[model samples]
Target: MAKRKWLRGLALLLLVALLVVGGMYLYGSSSGTVPPATVDFAKLSPEQEKTLYARGEQVFRAGDCAACHSSPQTGAELAGGVPMVTPMGTLYGTNISPSKQHGIGNWTADDLYRAIASGVAPSRKLLYPAMPYTSYHQVTRGDVDALWVWLMKQPAVEVANRANAMQFPFDVRPAVALWNAVERPAAKPFDASTDALSRGKYLVDVMGHCAECHSPRTLTFALDKSRYLEGSIIEGAYAPAITPAALSGRGWTRDDLVRFFRTGLSPQGVMTFRMASVLDHSTSHMPEEDLRAMAAYLTQDQAMPGPKPKAPQGEVNVKGEAIYVGLCAGCHGVQGQGQPQSSVPLNTNTTAMFPTPINLIRVTREGLQERDLPHGGRMQSMPGFADKLSDQDMADLVNYLRQTWGGQPGDVTPAQVADLVKTIEHGDQ
Candidate 1:
């Protein structure tokens, strides 16, 4: 009886797998109704071409592509050697350089556009969503063409591609096609509106893709609309909620936003982790008018009212202090000041001031990977400790750090700790 039951269960699982695979095969094979050759760059005028080139440069910075594609030690922009971690496994960014043998030297403008907009390669394999087509889809076609031109103009190097570290079921590319068919939204133009707020909304949603971090996602990696802009885990960092309610803890003002975007620092503290990388490579290079608009938009948005509850000054208990001493003191020092050579100062980290503890916990769990900085700078890498500490330990350690070093007494419940762990493990809040 037991053998019969096991066989039946196994059969059911196989059947479901077959159905999913078959659906993906059909979807990917048939749904690509358009040809790559349809990309018509001929329609662009000389002036339009120049504008597209400029916008493409902006998009490259905005997306922080160089940070991934470039090697930090060699200072090779877009030459590619960064390894990205995912639940499926680790995948390395490929050389987008125009090296004839190893990179996209032979790829046409259409190939580039399809790769960006549809996550489809020239050979029709679906790229992993880790490539962030969800955000790239908002990029205009003209901009993509210009980017292609710019990329081609760069010095090409023949750096070999690294093998992917994905698990068995996920190592396969066809599965992503299935995932896309079920979960991916088709690229569409930003909805036009008369008001500045409405326009800002479109930019943030489609072009900026702010929600990619600020919002949570389901187990299948679909955005959870219920808690839009409520913050989530991405790439080992907790992207905090940028909603009106969450910004109160940061004490952000209109001017602060503009300054932070322009210089990667605010009155609260300096940007670190992914946010700092974004500013140094992307936002700071954007037009001043756009920066002002983004700032104005954030200021107008409402935040949750009232003072956020934090650990009172010097109220960290002995237990919390012990956790920091035992685990953190070696790297962070006795006073929570990080090693200036390799670590960020915990006392003044912008991440320590977030309303929630996800960012703090996430960074502690997963050490950072070094990436490129604009103007020939490089950020230091840190190790992640997701598997090392328990929820109580994390809460205690973080509470101690925030109070002792971060000025604010940010209290984190065990429940919050558990929730953040779950979010990081699942790759979303």
Candidate 2:
């Protein structure tokens, strides 16, 4: 009798669990299915079509379509097998080439638009934010159409879509839909009144997706609007605050931004890691007009400015000075004056002068690596000392640099270094 009762109890437990799961799935709904686009390149006049393709190509570069979609293997082009390491799990980029079977060849213009601007797929499935569709949603219709044209023209590859490695609950697609349903309404829209400011807003907020990297996130992983673009830590590098308040003390100007975009170097220092990729693949190739527009938008406080960094208090570390003399001074110079050919110069550099020393710690620990340009030029990568240095050593080293070069205090602690090391080991900042 006890055995029979036990079996009945097990069956009841299983049924209850299923009901709970069913409830969750039913509640987690995505957006409606997107219809196929009606616009066709075949319908346009030859000159008009040519202009679109050209314009689309410009959008392609500005969007840096190749950065995410391009396969790592040489000659793969935009065949799409790049793996993005996120806090959730490893997600691979999908084949976005024009393959009817493997890529977006079958997707309609409306389908593409909705997916880019709404984060919804034709199947009514919510694309993971790992695809940047939340940011992409701000992209304009003309730019989306242009991107569609350019993508369709590229040669399609037969590469298969690699499955994402998300943990369960998160691995469930409906959960992503739930986020979309709750989060979409809150994203601020571009509402600038002036034409120049409006144009700049579109480029920075929509096409450039600047906040995608620079902004900090809430526990839900949504970009924290309260601290938008004030700066954030990224895996393998620091995404600095570009806010006027952050840049003001550093002597950054509109012309300085233009020059940095064009050369991947500011008067302060060289762009490194992903920023370097952005410059090489997108901004460097952008028309000077658009670059100026982007600068204008950033200058005009698209997001309300954060407080400027206060000068830190303290003398340079004695141990950190010894480490720099032995290791870093070979390149950055005895006085932290970096070389002309080095990736970053110490003096007037943005990394050191930032309020927090997380960036300096990150670069020193993990190092920086920029992708080679389409034209075959590549910047030198910073070598990581994680293998060689202790947590206390890093804290001391960074604290010293910030104190001396930035005229800031030595504030980084060994405990923080230990935490950063733990985070970086798990593939995040």
Candidate 3:
């Protein structure tokens, strides 16, 4: 009698568990109420089509869609082969061109809205959060409509999507429903009518989605709202804090912010890392007025101190100074005043001021590529020194930079550099 009762209890527990999981899957995989299409597709006149196409192009630039969706090899704007490396695994951007076989040519505006706003694709396919639908949850429906018209008009590229390399349970696409139920924010429309500040917030938070990288992630890899824009380490380098206070402390001014966004060059530094793609695809092409609004919103109209050299924090390392003079002083002046339009000055650069020395170390070892920036700004090639410097030498050089100009303690060690190298190599792979 006892054994029979125990078996019955076990069966009842299993049933209850199954019911709970089923409810979660149903709720999580379901799409939210999609907003009505802003324009009637069949009734559009030529003038309306033109207006929407222009607006859609603007929306695409602001959203930086090409940064991830463009082909690295062919430079096709929507062919979609860029690889995004994350802790869970690598995910390639999907083909978003107009090919009916491989792209969204047949998708209705409502389908795009569902994907962008609610993270649900057709046939109840759940997109991984790498798509940034969380930040796009509040995007306006009108913008999506305009984007759809423009996207469909572009020449179709017949490229199929690359398969994802997610590991273990994450490979099970349906399991993403649980993550959605727990962490996904509800889709809502943005209210940009309040003021310029509101418009700026819309551009930065909703359209630009800056916080997706700048903000720290929770253990579940969701953006931690508690530390919004406070900086985070991603893709093996630090995405520095961009809060108003952090910006002001780093000697950033509103004017400089606009200049950087428009030209990819400023006294602060040249754009590097993932931001290089951003400058090429998005900010350089943005309207001046929109750039100003983004800058003003970031600075909150606060009086900025601008760029100033930091005082030396400690005794300089002799070996580090020798390395700088031998290889660096020719381009960057001995006093750290960089050549105009070529090298960036070290004294005012913010890389060393960051809490971690990973960026400094990474850039030093790998160097930067020569490129022409927008608005006639250009930088010469910086050759990588990976084979030239030892781990100890790197630590000493970084320590010297931090102490002399970053106002940071010379505390970096060889062991730390070795560990950070592993991270850098993994990101490169």
Models sorted by lDDT, best on top: 3, 2, 1
List candidate 1 segments past 4 Å from native.
Answer: 1-24, 28-51, 191-203, 299-350, 353-397, 401-429
Model 2, global lDDT: 0.72
Error of 3 at 72 (Å): 1.1
The lDDT values for all models are 0.67, 0.72, 0.88
- Candidate 2 C-alpha lDDT tens digits along 59-111: 88777666667777754757887777777777887888788887888986777
The list of candidate 2 runs beyond 4 A from truth reads 1-42, 75-77, 186-194, 301-312, 366-382
* Cα-based TM-score, every candidate: 0.72, 0.84, 0.94
Q: Indicate the residue-level lDDT of 155 in model 1.
A: 84
Lowest-scoring 10 consecutive residues by lDDT in candidate 3? Answer: 20-29
C-alpha RMSD by candidate, in order: 5.8, 4.6, 4.2
| Local accuracy of candidate 1 as per-residue lDDT tens digits, 103-181 | 8898888788778767787766677877777766665565566688678767887788777888866776665776777
What's the C-alpha lDDT at position 377 in model 2? 45
lDDT, residue 94, candidate 3: 84
